[model samples]
Target: MTEHLTIVDHPLVQHKLTHMREKTTSTAGFRRLLREISNLLAYEVTRELPVTTREIETPMNTMQAPVLDGKKLVLVSILRAGNGLLDGVLELIPSARVGFVGLYRDEETLQPVQYYFKVPQELEDRLVIAVDPMLATGNSSVAAIDLLKKAGATNIRFMCLLAAPEGVARMKEAHPDVPIVTASLDERLNEDGYIVPGLGDAGDRMFGTK
Candidate 1:
């Protein structure tokens, strides 16, 4: 995931995202779809993870089997909506450590304000993947990464369900070294800083909040 941005356009990912975007979709349905899509996105995000082989004995033979190398990766959810994706990725990588970064947008300023932050130790020794449902303004994402870096994380990647061009540019400019992986790169953001043609406020829809 060295590229600045990676869009996963797999047919299944696109199909599930469509259903999630539908206004008529129920809360449970939206959540289920998000979890499924998260799995697909995780596959693309971890595509370049390091691997090593170890000799093992099979039923009737001995061979070297490839397995993930180094320390267990860290999954840092961006709080609230990020939990939706976190649940799915956890199922895929149960051994990975989990953490959270709590941030909210200041409507007037359209900036991010952090409220809470907690992550695993030895971040510099393991890969760090930050998960968030939407990358609308990118303020929160960039701010979160800033905190992660200050805490000793050298390798970090960002994962989101939907991203706006504005947010993508904001991230690239703020943190050129961190790569972004998303399901769709949607149209520009709206006046309120919402991703146009996006699946709406991910936190609201997933939680059935107004």
Candidate 2:
């Protein structure tokens, strides 16, 4: 993903996103849509992955089959909300390694505070994709990427269900090398730092916490 930001506007993605944004969608329904949409987004994110051919014998004949080059992917979920996207992506790349970064926002300051951190080994040798549901303030996403870099992740990508312009700009300024893939880039953040037109609190909606 060379582009700094890629918005997946596939008809299926947009259709499901509309259902997800509806306030009346049930927790079960919301969760289902997220998984489906994540599968599609994962396709877009991995579209440019390098591939090399290997000799393989098919039932009909021998042929060179294309396969991903390099180590299995490493997916690091920015805990809580990130878990929502994790399951769906894993379904697409089951062999990929998994990790977690737990950070909660300080309500008053709107800053991310690290509570837990763990990741797969050889991060620098493999591509690391960080999953988060909503990129509202960007503070949390930026901080999460910071930790990933410190842990030796040179190549990284950010994936989200929705993103705010503020969040995209923030990530670009902080980590321009890392690409962003999102379902929608909604309007500016509201007064409370939530995406104005975003599905309200992805984690809450998916988990039925609120």
Candidate 3:
């Protein structure tokens, strides 16, 4: 887990995250906060992106400055709740290509079944970031990554709003190469599989559902 986990501790991220955690936050408020926090998280996540020096002229001088190198980034949202994070990340990188993975758990078997998935044309050539609000059992997260890998994504990173210890360990064991950026690593999941002290189901809160 040492190599896989990178917890963001920026004050703005933490402050917005705190508002996202409050139970009284309305659907509109939750959506807005998630978007704001996601932008902050996206900033940290893309901080180390490869940059190439290019000549640029300022009002007073011409100098070489860094610019993003290689192909445009690809953002793969892990459905419903992932869209919430996606919205904010897009605000920062509006030109990034977008993809979607739709997975739903079968209550009886407790397994993830993919219903939809679409990725960019050349996945292997681009940096891919998979977004999801909660890393719960890690089943769906792992499954989503499997799909992306099958589609030729070699460089991948996982971004989430909140995560649990079990899920973090599971993701590390399943996909050690994919680093995870999260707001907070909370206590263990409750019996019902929700992260203890978590804000609640991100999809429900974001959409005024449930």
TM-score list, all predictions:
0.98, 0.98, 0.96
- Candidate 3 worst ten-residue window by lDDT: 103-112
* Candidate 1: tens digits of C-alpha lDDT, residues 1-210: 668999999999999999999989999999999999999999988999999999999999999999999999999999889999999999899999999999999999999989999999999999999999999989999999999999999999999999999999999999999999999999889999999899889999999998
Candidate lDDT scores, in order, read 0.95, 0.94, 0.92
Which tens-of-lDDT digit does each residue in 81-103 have in candidate 2?
Answer: 89989999999999999999999
Runs of candidate 2 with Cα error greater than 4 angstroms are none
How far out, in Å, is residue 133 in model 3? 0.4
lDDT of 3 by residue, 127-178 (tens): 9999999998888999999999999999999999999998999898999999
Q: How close is candidate 1 to the true structure, as a TM-score?
A: 0.98
